[model samples]
Target: MNALGLVVEYNPFHNGHFYHLAESKKETNADVVIAVMSGNFLQRGEPALISKWERTKMALHCGIDLVIELPYAFATQKANTFANGAVSILEALKCQSLCFGSELGEISSFLGANEFLHKSKQQYDELIKKQIKTGVSYPTALTNAFQELTNGKEILDLSLPNNILGFHYVKSIREQQAQMKPFTIQRTSAGYHEQNFVSPTIASATSIRKSIFSNEGDITNYVPSVTFQILNEYKMEKGLLHNWEQYFHLLKYSIMTMTEEDLLTIYEVEEGLENRIKKNILHAQSFQDFMERIKTKRYTWTRLQRLCTHILTKTTKQQMSFINDSQTAPYIRLLGMSSKGQEYLRSIKKQIELPIISKLATFRHPLLELDIKATNTYNMIFEEPLRSKLLKAEYATPPIRL
Candidate 1:
């Protein structure tokens, strides 16, 4: 029952991830590792390089005992929401501890940062609003707000990407008044967007993905051999390795065709962004080009990209708002579980509040439906024999039991 939970994308589960999983368990002296992993889509507004099940299998093959999905609604949103959803899942699963990689690699500063933000919420809000009105990106505006409140502390800069997420996780845990204890493992290799490998054994997912897209044939060094073999098999079968750019035409077609009213209905579409996106779609050549043309100080690229994904996938504002307002994850859908994981689930089944979904046929919810849509959307990207075989029905693919 005292599991150490991880919030992960594992875009491709690499050696660095394996290290974190191992270290987190050791640090917490946890009995099991539970991961609330993002599904076919990720937090960065990019499609995952491989299917979620494959990534789940990767986690199980390595060390993680149980993999539960972070539903598409929360998995592909801003960091705060992403953290909220992941933490909620872990909490609902009755995890006793939450572990994540952090750039600052220390708990005190993160705890301090969270406390400061809470105490200075009003001041921070005013500063953020002022910065946003002056045409700064929300993230930069947030950093500015934190700086103003902290009286020019470099905590924001030092935390970087992962640490920022960790801060949000702690904040969310407090917001939920959840019992999960928190722990941090210092990130040991390349940073989130670092384009170079830190060592033969550790590389950023960004770099490994870059190598995959460029056909560099040098990625196996960073990822485990199981990963290497699985990726190769996926490539031959499903044309696996890809990024957001692969969906250029789909995004463009969706944007170019949707009415202003239609765009407004999509989640995160607001304040005449529909007009801006419509105006730019004709001349904008690729997904990257289109993103640049529409991106403004008021709207960050990732925010805009998530909106684009929402439009393409038909995730509506009403649906997302319903889930957000409920302040609860709709259900607990296991992705894959080892025998030990199964034992844990059996032990906790009656205590957990939400429905534990084993078959899609047995329960239906809009959020889970959205997840299936995201998966099927990615499934459409493949060609030939793999495309047909890779096609999955939400009901048909039962959680893998190892």
Candidate 2:
């Protein structure tokens, strides 16, 4: 079977995602689509609006053939690291192509830009150093470097989040010498953060999430009916629906309890960021307040959010370095899959390079340890029956097979 791979965090699997999945299939003409998605925490350093199980069910319910979990370590990093892990999984799975949505849809243009960025990498690095010295943000420095190197060519615009991630996806393929072709579908209608519905059929994931958060507006107009229904069910039955801020106490407690040495061990808590966190944790009222207190021109809010997440989960620099130095994922953790997906996995089961974990019965690994801890940390938000059940579900729940 020709399998298509997608790097996704279908936080709620809204209409935009449904559109992307359908378009990716049409673009690739693959027999099955395999999605490596984020778990409870996302790249933005926030808890997912719903549980991964519900998100997987939402994807499978819509059109996805298979869903895999992008481990907590990789899923919560920047665009480059996030793309690297997702691309590596797709490559290992022998996928024919990677299908994703991006602001820049023209393949030829993106390729040309990719080539220029790769060739001028040294020059770009120097420019980034110079610009950073000038006090501009890293993303801004990158954009400036790209413009300087490309001489007004619209390549590596880094300002657009999707474009930045798309660049890294292509970069990962080239660096790994992977054979999977990349196909980009032009994003339609609303912008990445735009909250208003541009078209009923096409809306930003941000807008859908905001609507769900506020419990206002008709989200059914933006998501599939089944997705809405699942959200409703989880909202009422489990009282588990959440945003990032809900876990402030957990994050606060984690930061407050850790010493300087302990904080330094965690990934991204470098260069006295520990002290900044320690100082702020005593006074900051909420996660937003804490982040704002810690954020500087050099460290973006998202970066701080991710760092805070690392502190909450205790993903150490040593653990990250081990994964980096090894240049391989520890395992392939399946989240959910449809019947077609199951058949596809069965066919490739013998050939897969890493362990394919369907459940945590006897699993014992540092990476999986981080994943479990991440869930336990996220579950701190729930009260009573929901809290314990959420914690147990990670170990007890099997991959959704539909």
Candidate 3:
């Protein structure tokens, strides 16, 4: 069985995602579609609008054949680390190809960019470091360095969000010497961060989430019926959707009680950012306000949010040291699977390099422990029984078999 892999968040399975899934299958012509999805937290460092279980259901209900949890360690990281982890999982699963949606639809550009960067790595690193010294965000520095290196060349645009991720995906595949071929499809309609609906059916996940959060604009056309149903069911059961604003008080409390020295132990808390965060927490009203007060050219809002997520979950530098040492995830965590997915796993199970984890009790690793802590922290937003119920589900809930 040939499997095609996708690195996804599927925050809510929207029309755009549905289109991407379909196109990926068409492009790869693989027997099964596997998704390495973020768990309770996302790459942008925000708590998922719904739990990963719900999102898994959404993925299964859509076209995804198998849904595997991208562990909290990798899920909430920056682009390079996030892509490395996801691509590693796909390779370990013996996928024939990996497909991603990017603004630069052509796959050759990503391959060429990777080759160029590999050949000029030392020069590129020096350029990035020089650019970073100008107080620009790391992402900006990367884009500027790439443009300067390629000067007037039509290489992949590093500035676009999807393109950046695509470049990282290809780079990881090369670095790991994985056999999976990389593919890209042109993104349709909405942009990655577009918060307004630009199409009747195809909208960015950001816009879909914005619509749902504000309780304005109809999202019925933006997502599939199953996604709409699952979303409504989640809200009805949980009473409210998860968001940064909902956890602001808890985050502020976490910051208030911790000393600067204490925060320095948390991953990504460096260069006296702890003091900036501590100083701002006193006067900031909401999560957004705190972010605005603390954000500077050196740190992007997404970067700060990831740091806050680390602080909230108490993910320490020691706990995240595995990332610097290894690009691959230690295990493949199964979240849900369809019948076809089950057959594919059965066929490839013995050949897989990493342990396949289905139950929390059966797996014991610091990374997996962090995933549990993340789930616990995410569930803290709820009241009483629901909170306990969600936490218990982490262990008791088996992988969803469709």
Candidate 4:
């Protein structure tokens, strides 16, 4: 049984996502598709608008054979860690191939770029640091440095979401020497961060969420039927990230009460950003306003938000070190596996180098505890009271059958 793998957030399952899923199977010619998806918090450091189980059900109903949860810790991380977490899970599942969406559509080019990036990372790092020291923001500095090295060819358009992520996937697979073939499906008309629907048939998740929150035009064309069904059945409310001003007040209080040393402890609080963060906290009214005040050309808004999230969760240097140390994903944690996926797992169970975890109760490790806490935090974002009510939530959610 040829099995393919996908890593996703499915923040809300939409038509464009469906295309990627279907095309992944067709491109790989695989009988089973195993997905490693984010639990609740997405990569943007925002809470998911819907629940993970709802998203999982949508995936199972659509085309996926199995759906594993990408732990909240990794889901809300930077590109490398996010990709590492997802790729490691897929690799552990013994998948034959991995597929994802790409704006450029040329997976070959992405692979080439990945190789180049790795070989040149050291030089690139130095150049970027030099640029940053001269007062450019990190994002701009990195972009400029890459541009200088690539002669504006390969790194000119790193802003596209899929391209950036696709690069990470390639990097992870190469670093791990995983045996999965990597494939790409071209993204449709909608851009990943588009906040407004430009077309009737295509819209970004951002745009869809905006529509949902604002109670705008019909979103039926953009999302799949399964997703719509879940939205209706669950009576899912919109925008867990709705009140930016309220969150900003929390951040302001937290930053003001905390010391400089405390601010410096959070991940991504590098190069004395704490000073800027401390200053920005008082002036900002909304979350976006705070991000704007903190934004230098070096630090992107997304990066800042992730830093804030890290702070909110009180992620220490030790935990970050632990994540880096446990580089090779030690286990395949099955969320929901289908018959075909089970067969595939059985075939390679002996050859697999890592442990496969199904029951969290069996393994009482610190890492598992961290994972559970992250999930609970995610649940808090789901509905106000559900977060507390959903502690040890996975024990109740039975493995989905296909």
Query: Which is the leading candidate under lDDT?
Result: 3
**lDDT of each prediction vs. the true structure?**
0.85, 0.85, 0.93, 0.76
Q: Supply every candidate's count of residue pairs whose N, Cα or C atoms clash at under 3 angstroms.
A: 0, 0, 0, 4
Query: Which model, 2 or 3, shows the larger TM-score?
Result: 3
Q: Where is model 4 poorest over a 10-residue stretch in terms of lDDT?
A: 237-246
State the lDDT of candidate 3 residue by residue for 211-295, as single tens digits. 8888899999999999999989988977988899999999999999999999999999996798898899999999989999999
What's the CA RMSD of model 4 in angstroms?
Answer: 2.8
For candidate 2, the C-alpha RMSD (Å) to the true structure equals 1.6
lDDT string for model 1 (1-402, tens) is 578899999889998898998889989999988999999888878888888888988889988889999999889888888988888889999999999898877787778888888888898899989988888877888887777778886664533788779888989999999999888999886888888776868888988888888777598789888898888887786655767878888888887788889889999998688899899999988888988899887888788878888877878988888566865587898999999899988898888998888788898888998988888777766666656666645558999878
Candidate 3, residue 347: the lDDT equals 91
TM-score per candidate, chains pooled: 0.96, 0.96, 0.99, 0.89
Total backbone clashes of candidate 3, pairs 3 or more residues apart or in separate chains: 0
lDDT, candidate 2, 261-365, per-residue tens = 899999988777878889989999987787788888888888888888888888889878756775556788999999999999899888888888988976778
Decreasing lDDT order of the candidates: 3, 1, 2, 4
Error of 3 at 374 (Å): 0.2
Q: Listing every candidate in turn, what is its Cα RMSD in Å to the true structure after a full C-alpha superposition?
A: 1.7, 1.6, 0.7, 2.8
**Model 3 residue 105 lDDT score:** 93
Name the best candidate (by TM-score). 3
Kindly report which residue stretches of model 4 are placed more than 4 angstroms away from their true locations once superposed. Answer: 118-121, 154-156, 236-257, 282-285, 381-387
